[model samples]
Target: MAKLLLCSLAWFTFPSFADNKPLNSPVDYLSVLLSLVVVIAMVFMLGYLMRRFNVTQHGGGQMKVVGSMALGTRERILVIQVGEEQHMLGVTAQNINHLARLETPLEVPQASGDNFKNKLSQLMQGHKGKTDE
Candidate 1:
């Protein structure tokens, strides 16, 4: 047992006596570190760009259920609106049954000759009323 322990200790320490040369040159290590940093920076930059462009907004709010069209006998397409954006999502009969409990409009109303300027004016008026209140 003593011999075995000594042999094991020697085996562990033997590598420490060998030449301590780094596997990669200093320049190579620096290049690798720089590449890693650049990759991380690029990833963060891409994320920032996506956020700036509002590319990640989805599926949250007083969603307007546009339609529930049949896909199969059991599955259907569920079209929903989040803010001004619309999304058509696939849903099963289970989801359709669940959706039936919610106060979804039978039909979304079309703009009654109201243009962008009128909408903007209405929004501004609403904002002014809120501020006054």
Candidate 2:
């Protein structure tokens, strides 16, 4: 047991021998900083790409979120449109429960369906037409 304990203790104390080497090297620090920056930049880049694509998506898919309401911090009600039918669902932290299937599907707002790109293109077209005149 003492041999095992000494062996474990010796393993833990190997870093103490590293006192011969400097604790902080500028090159090491800079490389770590650059690596962190690159990882963060990649994350932001991927997020931007996903957001850009998602924003340009048109509405009126076969399955769509018709509406949603927050009941609490971790609970909410969601109305999803599948084909021609709408389903009401209760969402909680644990699980999702289907409340009912609505006979009439609720209307999805015009704004939710229209993304910024479509609106911007329409605005540019109007501007171009005005300039042509």
Candidate 3:
């Protein structure tokens, strides 16, 4: 009985030992490399699609107000150029509530500037005062 049990165990263990041999087929290596390439290409394609369709179309020209009554909403600070004059408009979610209007539009300055920051901060302060009153 011991011999029979040992024989069966040896047979089962022999098959498992064969499985430890490294995969030696070119087909297996090619399949693995192809799968990796496909996954990387898919990731890059998805990113490109997102940039082309979603981000580039609608993710430009946004401004943030420093301190104001407009607590939670996307504020867009627009510098509209009409000939030599530029108009600064703060458009809130509710309506085109005039936060501040620049007389000369300050030469289409970059989004980050002392003038823009000061104006946005002052507008917010004024809006807060009005709401408190």
Which candidate order results from sorting by lDDT in descending order?
Answer: 2, 1, 3
What is each predicted model's overall lDDT from 0 to 1?
0.61, 0.75, 0.58
- Stretches of candidate 2 above 4 Å error? 1-28, 44-62, 109-114
Per-residue lDDT of model 1, residues 1-133, tens digit only: 6469545644444433245544355665665456557657877998999888657664335776666678688888776766655666768856533342324434555433446668889999999999998
Stretches of model 1 off by over 4 angstroms after superposition: 1-22, 58-133
> Candidate 3 regions off by >4 Å?
1-21, 55-133
Assess every candidate by TM-score. Answer: 0.29, 0.57, 0.30
TM-score winner: 2
Q: Model 1: how large is the Cα RMSD against the reference? A: 18.6
Q: On residues 22-62, what C-alpha lDDT tens digit does candidate 2 reach at each position?
A: 43666655654565576578779978998976766656568
State, as a TM-score between 0 and 1, how close model 1 is to the true structure: 0.29
- Backbone clash count, each prediction separately: 0, 0, 1
lDDT of 3 by residue, 1-133 (tens): 6469546644454443346655477765665566557657877997998876545442134442322333445766665554555555667776775545556445444443466799999999999999999
Best by lDDT: 2
Give residue 7's error in model 2 in angstroms. Answer: 41
